[model samples]
Target: MNEIISGEKILVTGGAGFIGSNLCEVLLDSNNTVVCLDNFATGKQENIAPFLKHPKFSFIQGDIRNLEDCLLATKNVDYVLHQAALGSVPRSIKNPITTNEVNISGFLNMLVASRDHHIKRFVYAASSSTYGDSQALPKVEENIGKPLSPYAVTKLVNELYADVFFKTYGLETIGLRYFNVFGKRQDPNGAYAAVIPKFVKQFMQLESPIINGDGTFSRDFTYIDNVVQANLKSLVASSTSVNNVYNIAFGDRNTLNDLVVYLKEYLAIYKPSIEKVPVIYGSERVGDIPHSHASIQKAKKYLNYQPEFSLQKGLQEAVDWYWKNL
Candidate 1:
């Protein structure tokens, strides 16, 4: 078993959310004391309920938008994993101001708090949506294009602030540009839910799933476990790993049609009728890129990252989890 350094105290903002809670569990399993700070805007207490009994786990109900809460959470923390942000392109498009407040301004609060606390490292969740208008097949770290949405703009601002903090204040920050992350604990009932979990939930209920485009649009859907691994690795990664950005993805792409077939097959065990349900097609979402695939070369070389699950394998595990939990 891989273990976090002894006596290390860690703070995870948004630690009650899908990705944050998973990271908290892994860190606790690795023998680290964890403080989970969340306002529950998008997070749920049930996600972290299993860890409430653990001696090393603590939960603080707080929002990142508040400087006092951020400071309190950062006190004596060795590492800061900033996952508290309002995600979803449509949500941002609908309400850019609130999204900016949480994703951009809130991120600044955490960065300032972390720097003040003298934290060892600050790792944050960036997004592949930052690739924006770029028409490249596989996005590399160095190449980027104009942001297509307010959400992408905010994420790009996060990277910029992280870089400035490192250069101006000597803070060690690493940004993980996640590409369509999905898996267990991801909310499937919401209006802005990611495709996989949403589809699984609809299929489980024998509802027609909707595809945003002609089902030709593809994405590099990464599993949650891989994202957790990237967070852990980025924390204690070599000194050379700081002040960098890495694409945390499976490196493969899957179209919505392929995903539908896989989901139907997996869900047939629980709801046998779902196999016959066909997915409905809709117009392409505004501000959405046509294709997105990431080059993991940088993460592979610098972070020693090795993705353990392929799309099919990950989908199977995710479907089973949704079936059992939902």
Candidate 2:
């Protein structure tokens, strides 16, 4: 929290969405004047409603695909936390054109605007999916494989564009490759909703959620708070080189079955019958990674990032929030 540079003007690209809204809240709490630019395509209005009246909070309902929106939102902003992008590997497979248009084209637009405005640092969301089919257990930044899906390609392209912006245009940039980030306000109703929230919702309804691929596929389930820490560190720290990418994760892996167990355990406090809920196994979805893990050495050594929430700790908090809010 002390890392925040008070009074600095920060623009968060997807300010009405899950990760972006959390970033805006933290930045505003730190006394930074924050501007949010979102088109509401996937970002919900309810997510940003709490901050609509804040003195330091400004909202611009705009699309990143349009360069004019980027320029207007970035004007006079000191830093840009670029979190606006279409997510979900399955969704991208179904619609690559839209994903490319938003993730890649829109990302370039933000970079151009940030460069023109001379922003201090451009911290954008990268993805663990960039690892693709590499078969690496603890994913390192340098190692990667051919992207398995359009979504992976888009995120990887973001890293490339950020690197080019820093080298060619001299815009300082850092990319955080997030791993299975989950927390409150994350949309759980969508077809592409993340596993944790989706399962939480299903269990709340006393319904069984389907687990893909025998429930053995594991992921480094990072908590959103840890991701927030990484973003804040990258925004304020000069420890790492510009145009770099680091894995933002809990540095621990959990199987889908393991995740359900935790959710039931925590959620049972509110809905006693949820503990008896069952999960069915379905055929593995195409473009799904078998197992994923991350080595946080780079972020730790460079940005001094110390993840504050473990999977269990984050689940406790998330379950509590969902029970009260849902």
What are the models' TM-scores? 0.98, 0.98
lDDT of 1 at 89: 98
Cα lDDT listed for each candidate: 0.92, 0.92
lDDT of 2 by residue, 202-291 (tens): 999999999988999999999888998899889878835567999999898999989999999999999899999989999999999999
| Full-model lDDT, candidate 2 | 0.92
Write down the TM-score for model 2: 0.98
What pairs collide in candidate 1? Answer: none
Worst 10 residues of 1 by lDDT: 1-10
Clashes of each: 0, 0
Which ranges of candidate 1 are over 4 A from the true structure? 1-6
lDDT of 2 at 280: 93
